[model samples]
Target: MSALILKDFYVMWKQTKVLLIIILVFSCLPGAFYPTFAVIYAAILPYSAMAYDERSKWDQLAGMLPYADRDIVLGKYLFGYLSIAVAAGLSLVIQTALTLFWERASDNLSPLSTIPLAVCVGVCVLALTLPLMFRFGVEKGRLVMFLIIFLVCGSTGVLTGISSDSLDGGYYLSLALPAAALAAVVLTAVSIPMSLRMYRRRRA
Candidate 1:
Protein backbone atom coordinates (compact mmCIF):
# COMPACT_ATOMS: atom_id res chain seq x y z
CA MET A 1 0.00 0.00 0.00
CA SER A 2 2.75 2.38 0.94
CA ALA A 3 4.70 1.60 -2.22
CA LEU A 4 1.59 2.04 -4.36
CA ILE A 5 0.94 5.42 -2.80
CA LEU A 6 4.56 6.41 -3.28
CA LYS A 7 4.31 5.54 -6.96
CA ASP A 8 1.26 7.78 -7.32
CA PHE A 9 3.09 10.57 -5.55
CA TYR A 10 6.08 10.09 -7.80
CA VAL A 11 3.92 10.54 -10.88
CA MET A 12 2.20 13.60 -9.45
CA TRP A 13 5.50 15.13 -8.44
CA LYS A 14 6.30 15.60 -12.09
CA GLN A 15 3.55 18.21 -12.18
CA THR A 16 4.33 19.76 -8.84
CA LYS A 17 5.97 22.71 -10.46
CA VAL A 18 2.82 23.46 -12.43
CA LEU A 19 0.76 23.30 -9.29
CA LEU A 20 3.19 25.63 -7.58
CA ILE A 21 2.90 28.12 -10.41
CA ILE A 22 -0.86 28.09 -10.00
CA ILE A 23 -0.55 28.69 -6.27
CA LEU A 24 1.87 31.51 -6.90
CA VAL A 25 -0.50 33.17 -9.33
CA PHE A 26 -3.43 32.98 -6.95
CA SER A 27 -1.24 34.06 -4.05
CA CYS A 28 -0.42 37.34 -5.68
CA LEU A 29 -4.00 38.49 -5.26
CA PRO A 30 -5.40 39.98 -2.06
CA GLY A 31 -5.94 37.31 0.55
CA ALA A 32 -9.57 38.20 1.05
CA PHE A 33 -10.12 38.01 -2.68
CA TYR A 34 -7.91 35.05 -3.47
CA PRO A 35 -8.78 32.54 -0.76
CA THR A 36 -12.14 31.65 -2.28
CA PHE A 37 -10.58 31.15 -5.70
CA ALA A 38 -7.71 29.25 -4.16
CA VAL A 39 -10.11 26.84 -2.54
CA ILE A 40 -11.85 26.19 -5.85
CA TYR A 41 -8.53 25.89 -7.64
CA ALA A 42 -7.21 23.38 -5.14
CA ALA A 43 -10.34 21.30 -5.44
CA ILE A 44 -9.63 20.62 -9.14
CA LEU A 45 -6.22 19.06 -8.56
CA PRO A 46 -7.54 15.66 -7.54
CA TYR A 47 -9.90 15.35 -10.44
CA SER A 48 -7.25 16.44 -12.90
CA ALA A 49 -4.65 14.10 -11.50
CA MET A 50 -7.02 11.15 -11.48
CA ALA A 51 -8.06 11.91 -15.01
CA TYR A 52 -4.43 11.95 -16.06
CA ASP A 53 -3.89 8.54 -14.50
CA GLU A 54 -6.93 7.11 -16.21
CA ARG A 55 -5.90 8.61 -19.52
CA SER A 56 -2.44 7.11 -19.28
CA LYS A 57 -3.94 3.74 -18.29
CA TRP A 58 -1.71 3.69 -15.25
CA ASP A 59 -4.46 2.25 -13.07
CA GLN A 60 -4.80 -0.72 -15.43
CA LEU A 61 -1.09 -1.43 -15.24
CA ALA A 62 -1.23 -0.98 -11.47
CA GLY A 63 -4.10 -3.45 -11.27
CA MET A 64 -2.06 -6.12 -13.05
CA LEU A 65 0.67 -5.71 -10.47
CA PRO A 66 0.59 -6.98 -6.90
CA TYR A 67 -2.28 -4.71 -5.82
CA ALA A 68 -6.00 -4.97 -5.14
CA ASP A 69 -8.76 -2.69 -6.30
CA ARG A 70 -9.24 -1.18 -2.87
CA ASP A 71 -5.58 -0.45 -2.62
CA ILE A 72 -5.56 1.38 -5.93
CA VAL A 73 -8.72 3.31 -5.13
CA LEU A 74 -7.65 4.25 -1.64
CA GLY A 75 -4.13 5.08 -2.70
CA LYS A 76 -5.32 7.43 -5.43
CA TYR A 77 -7.74 9.09 -3.04
CA LEU A 78 -5.05 9.58 -0.43
CA PHE A 79 -2.68 11.05 -2.95
CA GLY A 80 -5.36 13.47 -4.05
CA TYR A 81 -6.14 14.45 -0.49
CA LEU A 82 -2.49 14.91 0.41
CA SER A 83 -1.82 16.96 -2.70
CA ILE A 84 -4.71 19.29 -1.95
CA ALA A 85 -3.78 19.54 1.70
CA VAL A 86 -0.30 20.69 0.79
CA ALA A 87 -1.66 23.13 -1.76
CA ALA A 88 -4.16 24.49 0.75
CA GLY A 89 -1.45 24.99 3.34
CA LEU A 90 0.77 26.83 0.91
CA SER A 91 -2.22 28.93 -0.21
CA LEU A 92 -2.84 29.93 3.38
CA VAL A 93 0.74 31.07 3.72
CA ILE A 94 0.52 33.06 0.50
CA GLN A 95 -2.75 34.59 1.59
CA THR A 96 -1.21 35.60 4.92
CA ALA A 97 1.78 37.17 3.23
CA LEU A 98 -0.40 39.12 0.82
CA THR A 99 -2.65 40.28 3.61
CA LEU A 100 0.30 41.43 5.68
CA PHE A 101 1.81 43.17 2.70
CA TRP A 102 -1.37 45.04 2.02
CA GLU A 103 -1.81 46.03 5.63
CA ARG A 104 1.76 47.24 5.88
CA ALA A 105 1.35 49.26 2.71
CA SER A 106 -1.62 51.00 4.30
CA ASP A 107 0.24 51.45 7.58
CA ASN A 108 -2.58 49.67 9.39
CA LEU A 109 -1.23 46.19 9.77
CA SER A 110 -3.32 44.08 12.12
CA PRO A 111 -3.70 40.34 12.25
CA LEU A 112 -5.72 39.23 9.25
CA SER A 113 -8.42 36.67 9.82
CA THR A 114 -8.23 35.12 6.35
CA ILE A 115 -6.25 32.04 7.43
CA PRO A 116 -9.17 30.35 9.11
CA LEU A 117 -11.50 31.51 6.40
CA ALA A 118 -9.21 30.04 3.73
CA VAL A 119 -9.04 26.81 5.69
CA CYS A 120 -12.80 26.71 5.97
CA VAL A 121 -13.14 27.21 2.25
CA GLY A 122 -10.54 24.51 1.60
CA VAL A 123 -12.43 22.12 3.85
CA CYS A 124 -15.65 22.85 2.10
CA VAL A 125 -14.05 22.22 -1.27
CA LEU A 126 -12.60 18.90 -0.16
CA ALA A 127 -15.84 17.82 1.48
CA LEU A 128 -17.77 18.48 -1.68
CA THR A 129 -15.26 17.34 -4.32
CA LEU A 130 -13.55 14.21 -2.97
CA PRO A 131 -16.65 12.06 -2.80
CA LEU A 132 -17.73 13.03 -6.27
CA MET A 133 -14.38 12.04 -7.70
CA PHE A 134 -14.46 8.74 -5.88
CA ARG A 135 -18.03 7.82 -6.67
CA PHE A 136 -18.20 8.89 -10.29
CA GLY A 137 -14.63 8.51 -11.51
CA VAL A 138 -12.86 11.57 -12.85
CA GLU A 139 -14.54 11.79 -16.25
CA LYS A 140 -18.09 11.62 -14.97
CA GLY A 141 -17.16 13.56 -11.85
CA ARG A 142 -16.91 16.76 -13.88
CA LEU A 143 -20.69 16.91 -13.93
CA VAL A 144 -20.75 16.52 -10.17
CA MET A 145 -18.24 19.32 -9.96
CA PHE A 146 -20.48 21.65 -11.91
CA LEU A 147 -23.47 20.74 -9.81
CA ILE A 148 -21.52 21.24 -6.61
CA ILE A 149 -20.31 24.63 -7.74
CA PHE A 150 -23.84 25.69 -8.50
CA LEU A 151 -25.11 24.34 -5.21
CA VAL A 152 -22.35 25.94 -3.22
CA CYS A 153 -22.88 29.31 -4.86
CA GLY A 154 -26.64 29.15 -4.53
CA SER A 155 -26.46 27.97 -0.94
CA THR A 156 -24.03 30.67 0.01
CA GLY A 157 -26.21 33.28 -1.59
CA VAL A 158 -29.29 31.95 0.16
CA LEU A 159 -27.54 31.82 3.51
CA THR A 160 -26.14 35.30 3.11
CA GLY A 161 -29.51 36.61 2.07
CA ILE A 162 -31.34 34.96 4.92
CA SER A 163 -29.25 36.44 7.67
CA SER A 164 -25.88 38.05 7.29
CA ASP A 165 -25.29 37.43 10.97
CA SER A 166 -25.15 33.69 10.28
CA LEU A 167 -21.81 34.29 8.64
CA ASP A 168 -20.39 35.99 11.68
CA GLY A 169 -17.05 34.67 12.89
CA GLY A 170 -18.37 33.02 16.02
CA TYR A 171 -21.26 31.37 14.22
CA TYR A 172 -19.05 30.14 11.41
CA LEU A 173 -16.49 28.71 13.82
CA SER A 174 -18.97 27.08 16.15
CA LEU A 175 -21.42 25.72 13.63
CA ALA A 176 -20.34 25.81 9.99
CA LEU A 177 -16.80 24.59 10.51
CA PRO A 178 -17.77 21.58 12.59
CA ALA A 179 -20.58 20.64 10.24
CA ALA A 180 -18.26 20.78 7.22
CA ALA A 181 -15.67 18.65 8.98
CA LEU A 182 -18.22 16.03 9.89
CA ALA A 183 -19.54 15.97 6.36
CA ALA A 184 -16.01 15.59 4.97
CA VAL A 185 -15.31 12.65 7.25
CA VAL A 186 -18.53 10.91 6.33
CA LEU A 187 -18.14 11.54 2.61
CA THR A 188 -14.57 10.28 2.54
CA ALA A 189 -15.46 7.18 4.51
CA VAL A 190 -18.38 6.35 2.27
CA SER A 191 -16.62 7.16 -0.97
CA ILE A 192 -13.64 4.86 -0.41
CA PRO A 193 -15.66 1.63 -0.35
CA MET A 194 -17.83 2.79 -3.19
CA SER A 195 -14.73 3.55 -5.23
CA LEU A 196 -13.26 0.19 -4.45
CA ARG A 197 -16.43 -1.59 -5.53
CA MET A 198 -16.62 0.43 -8.69
CA TYR A 199 -13.03 -0.26 -9.58
CA ARG A 200 -13.44 -3.99 -8.93
CA ARG A 201 -16.54 -4.24 -11.06
CA ARG A 202 -14.90 -2.28 -13.84
CA ARG A 203 -11.82 -4.43 -13.75
CA ALA A 204 -13.79 -7.67 -13.53
Candidate 2:
Protein backbone atom coordinates (compact mmCIF):
# COMPACT_ATOMS: atom_id res chain seq x y z
CA MET A 1 0.00 0.00 0.00
CA SER A 2 2.81 2.39 0.88
CA ALA A 3 4.51 1.55 -2.42
CA LEU A 4 1.27 2.11 -4.29
CA ILE A 5 0.82 5.51 -2.67
CA LEU A 6 4.44 6.41 -3.42
CA LYS A 7 3.98 5.36 -7.05
CA ASP A 8 1.00 7.68 -7.40
CA PHE A 9 2.95 10.54 -5.79
CA TYR A 10 5.80 10.02 -8.21
CA VAL A 11 3.39 9.90 -11.12
CA MET A 12 1.80 13.13 -9.88
CA TRP A 13 5.14 14.85 -9.43
CA LYS A 14 6.21 13.86 -12.91
CA GLN A 15 2.94 14.39 -14.75
CA THR A 16 0.89 16.99 -12.92
CA LYS A 17 3.28 19.82 -12.24
CA VAL A 18 1.02 22.26 -14.05
CA LEU A 19 -1.97 21.33 -11.90
CA LEU A 20 0.13 21.65 -8.78
CA ILE A 21 1.22 25.10 -9.90
CA ILE A 22 -2.41 26.04 -10.43
CA ILE A 23 -3.25 24.91 -6.90
CA LEU A 24 -0.41 27.01 -5.51
CA VAL A 25 -1.59 30.02 -7.46
CA PHE A 26 -5.18 29.53 -6.30
CA SER A 27 -4.08 29.10 -2.70
CA CYS A 28 -2.45 32.51 -2.86
CA LEU A 29 -5.69 34.14 -3.95
CA PRO A 30 -7.56 36.38 -1.47
CA GLY A 31 -10.81 34.53 -0.93
CA ALA A 32 -12.26 31.38 0.65
CA PHE A 33 -13.39 30.06 -2.74
CA TYR A 34 -9.93 30.00 -4.29
CA PRO A 35 -8.36 28.31 -1.29
CA THR A 36 -11.17 25.77 -1.26
CA PHE A 37 -10.56 25.17 -4.94
CA ALA A 38 -6.91 24.48 -4.19
CA VAL A 39 -7.73 21.78 -1.65
CA ILE A 40 -10.46 20.08 -3.67
CA TYR A 41 -8.41 20.21 -6.85
CA ALA A 42 -5.53 18.61 -5.02
CA ALA A 43 -7.85 15.83 -3.99
CA ILE A 44 -8.46 15.02 -7.67
CA LEU A 45 -4.81 14.17 -8.28
CA PRO A 46 -5.56 10.53 -7.46
CA TYR A 47 -8.11 10.45 -10.23
CA SER A 48 -5.48 11.66 -12.65
CA ALA A 49 -3.13 8.95 -11.44
CA MET A 50 -5.82 6.37 -11.97
CA ALA A 51 -6.35 7.61 -15.50
CA TYR A 52 -2.65 7.10 -16.24
CA ASP A 53 -2.77 3.67 -14.68
CA GLU A 54 -5.61 2.71 -16.97
CA ARG A 55 -3.84 4.05 -20.04
CA SER A 56 -0.87 1.81 -19.21
CA LYS A 57 -3.05 -1.17 -18.22
CA TRP A 58 -1.56 -1.05 -14.75
CA ASP A 59 -4.46 -3.00 -13.35
CA GLN A 60 -3.64 -6.03 -15.53
CA LEU A 61 -0.03 -5.88 -14.35
CA ALA A 62 -1.05 -5.25 -10.77
CA GLY A 63 -3.12 -8.44 -10.80
CA MET A 64 0.03 -10.43 -11.49
CA LEU A 65 1.61 -8.96 -8.33
CA PRO A 66 0.91 -10.25 -4.83
CA TYR A 67 -1.18 -7.33 -3.65
CA ALA A 68 -4.93 -7.86 -3.35
CA ASP A 69 -7.63 -5.78 -5.03
CA ARG A 70 -8.34 -4.17 -1.66
CA ASP A 71 -4.81 -2.83 -1.55
CA ILE A 72 -5.13 -1.21 -4.96
CA VAL A 73 -8.51 0.34 -4.21
CA LEU A 74 -7.65 1.49 -0.71
CA GLY A 75 -4.34 2.82 -1.92
CA LYS A 76 -6.08 5.32 -4.18
CA TYR A 77 -8.34 6.41 -1.33
CA LEU A 78 -5.41 6.80 1.04
CA PHE A 79 -3.48 8.76 -1.56
CA GLY A 80 -6.42 11.09 -2.03
CA TYR A 81 -6.83 11.52 1.75
CA LEU A 82 -3.16 12.44 2.14
CA SER A 83 -3.29 14.78 -0.83
CA ILE A 84 -6.28 16.63 0.60
CA ALA A 85 -4.59 16.91 4.00
CA VAL A 86 -1.40 18.33 2.51
CA ALA A 87 -3.32 20.79 0.33
CA ALA A 88 -5.59 21.89 3.16
CA GLY A 89 -2.63 22.37 5.47
CA LEU A 90 -0.72 24.35 2.86
CA SER A 91 -3.76 26.42 1.97
CA LEU A 92 -4.31 27.25 5.63
CA VAL A 93 -0.67 28.18 6.23
CA ILE A 94 -0.44 30.25 3.05
CA GLN A 95 -3.68 32.03 3.77
CA THR A 96 -2.52 32.73 7.33
CA ALA A 97 0.74 34.19 6.09
CA LEU A 98 -1.05 36.25 3.45
CA THR A 99 -3.56 37.58 5.94
CA LEU A 100 -0.68 38.62 8.18
CA PHE A 101 1.59 40.10 5.50
CA TRP A 102 -0.69 41.35 2.76
CA GLU A 103 -2.84 44.41 3.37
CA ARG A 104 -5.20 43.31 0.61
CA ALA A 105 -5.77 39.86 2.03
CA SER A 106 -9.22 39.42 3.45
CA ASP A 107 -9.24 38.49 7.11
CA ASN A 108 -12.70 37.17 6.39
CA LEU A 109 -11.10 34.48 4.25
CA SER A 110 -10.68 32.91 7.70
CA PRO A 111 -8.19 30.16 6.99
CA LEU A 112 -8.80 28.64 10.40
CA SER A 113 -12.50 28.34 9.69
CA THR A 114 -12.59 27.80 5.94
CA ILE A 115 -9.99 25.02 5.75
CA PRO A 116 -12.05 22.51 7.72
CA LEU A 117 -14.99 22.92 5.38
CA ALA A 118 -12.72 22.65 2.36
CA VAL A 119 -11.18 19.47 3.70
CA CYS A 120 -14.62 18.04 4.34
CA VAL A 121 -15.74 18.95 0.86
CA GLY A 122 -12.60 17.40 -0.62
CA VAL A 123 -13.18 14.19 1.32
CA CYS A 124 -16.78 14.04 0.18
CA VAL A 125 -15.71 14.60 -3.41
CA LEU A 126 -13.44 11.57 -3.20
CA ALA A 127 -16.20 9.59 -1.58
CA LEU A 128 -18.57 10.43 -4.39
CA THR A 129 -16.15 9.93 -7.27
CA LEU A 130 -13.85 7.00 -6.38
CA PRO A 131 -16.54 4.35 -6.60
CA LEU A 132 -17.48 5.58 -10.05
CA MET A 133 -13.87 5.27 -11.16
CA PHE A 134 -13.65 1.79 -9.71
CA ARG A 135 -16.89 0.51 -11.23
CA PHE A 136 -16.37 2.08 -14.62
CA GLY A 137 -12.98 2.68 -16.16
CA VAL A 138 -11.40 6.09 -15.58
CA GLU A 139 -12.32 7.17 -19.10
CA LYS A 140 -16.00 6.54 -18.53
CA GLY A 141 -15.85 8.04 -15.05
CA ARG A 142 -14.20 11.29 -16.22
CA LEU A 143 -17.45 12.91 -17.34
CA VAL A 144 -19.24 12.24 -14.05
CA MET A 145 -16.21 13.44 -12.14
CA PHE A 146 -16.24 16.72 -14.06
CA LEU A 147 -19.93 17.20 -13.37
CA ILE A 148 -19.29 16.53 -9.69
CA ILE A 149 -16.48 19.05 -9.71
CA PHE A 150 -18.67 21.65 -11.33
CA LEU A 151 -21.38 21.18 -8.72
CA VAL A 152 -18.98 21.20 -5.79
CA CYS A 153 -17.19 24.30 -7.05
CA GLY A 154 -20.54 25.98 -7.63
CA SER A 155 -21.50 25.28 -4.01
CA THR A 156 -18.50 27.23 -2.79
CA GLY A 157 -20.31 30.33 -3.99
CA VAL A 158 -22.87 29.71 -1.29
CA LEU A 159 -20.10 29.48 1.24
CA THR A 160 -18.59 32.74 0.06
CA GLY A 161 -21.98 34.44 0.06
CA ILE A 162 -22.37 33.78 3.78
CA SER A 163 -21.15 36.80 5.70
CA SER A 164 -18.31 36.28 8.15
CA ASP A 165 -20.52 37.48 10.97
CA SER A 166 -23.27 35.04 10.02
CA LEU A 167 -20.80 32.19 10.03
CA ASP A 168 -19.92 33.36 13.56
CA GLY A 169 -16.56 31.80 14.26
CA GLY A 170 -17.78 30.02 17.38
CA TYR A 171 -20.89 28.69 15.68
CA TYR A 172 -18.86 27.51 12.69
CA LEU A 173 -16.37 25.72 14.90
CA SER A 174 -18.94 24.13 17.19
CA LEU A 175 -21.68 23.29 14.71
CA ALA A 176 -20.81 23.54 11.02
CA LEU A 177 -17.37 21.94 11.27
CA PRO A 178 -18.62 18.98 13.25
CA ALA A 179 -21.55 18.48 10.95
CA ALA A 180 -19.33 18.53 7.90
CA ALA A 181 -16.87 16.15 9.54
CA LEU A 182 -19.61 13.70 10.38
CA ALA A 183 -20.97 13.82 6.85
CA ALA A 184 -17.53 13.24 5.34
CA VAL A 185 -16.90 10.31 7.67
CA VAL A 186 -20.20 8.68 6.85
CA LEU A 187 -19.78 9.12 3.12
CA THR A 188 -16.20 7.81 3.21
CA ALA A 189 -17.17 4.81 5.26
CA VAL A 190 -19.74 3.90 2.68
CA SER A 191 -17.54 4.80 -0.26
CA ILE A 192 -14.64 2.58 0.74
CA PRO A 193 -16.66 -0.60 0.77
CA MET A 194 -18.37 0.29 -2.46
CA SER A 195 -15.04 0.98 -4.14
CA LEU A 196 -13.58 -2.25 -2.84
CA ARG A 197 -16.52 -4.25 -4.09
CA MET A 198 -16.49 -2.58 -7.48
CA TYR A 199 -12.77 -3.07 -7.95
CA ARG A 200 -13.05 -6.72 -7.01
CA ARG A 201 -15.91 -7.20 -9.43
CA ARG A 202 -13.97 -5.47 -12.13
CA ARG A 203 -11.01 -7.71 -11.45
CA ALA A 204 -13.15 -10.82 -11.60
Predicted model with the maximum lDDT: 2
Per-residue CA lDDT of candidate 2, range 98-136, in tens?
878887775465655677787887888889888988989
lDDT digits (tens) for residues 115-149 of candidate 1: 33434444455555555565667777778878657
lDDT score, candidate 2, position 198: 89
Off by over 4 Å in 1: 2-20, 104-136, 140-142, 148-170
CA RMSD of all predictions: 4.4, 2.0
Write out the backbone clash pairs for model 2.
Answer: none
Poorest stretch of ten by lDDT in candidate 2: 158-167
Error of 1 at 53 (Å): 1.7
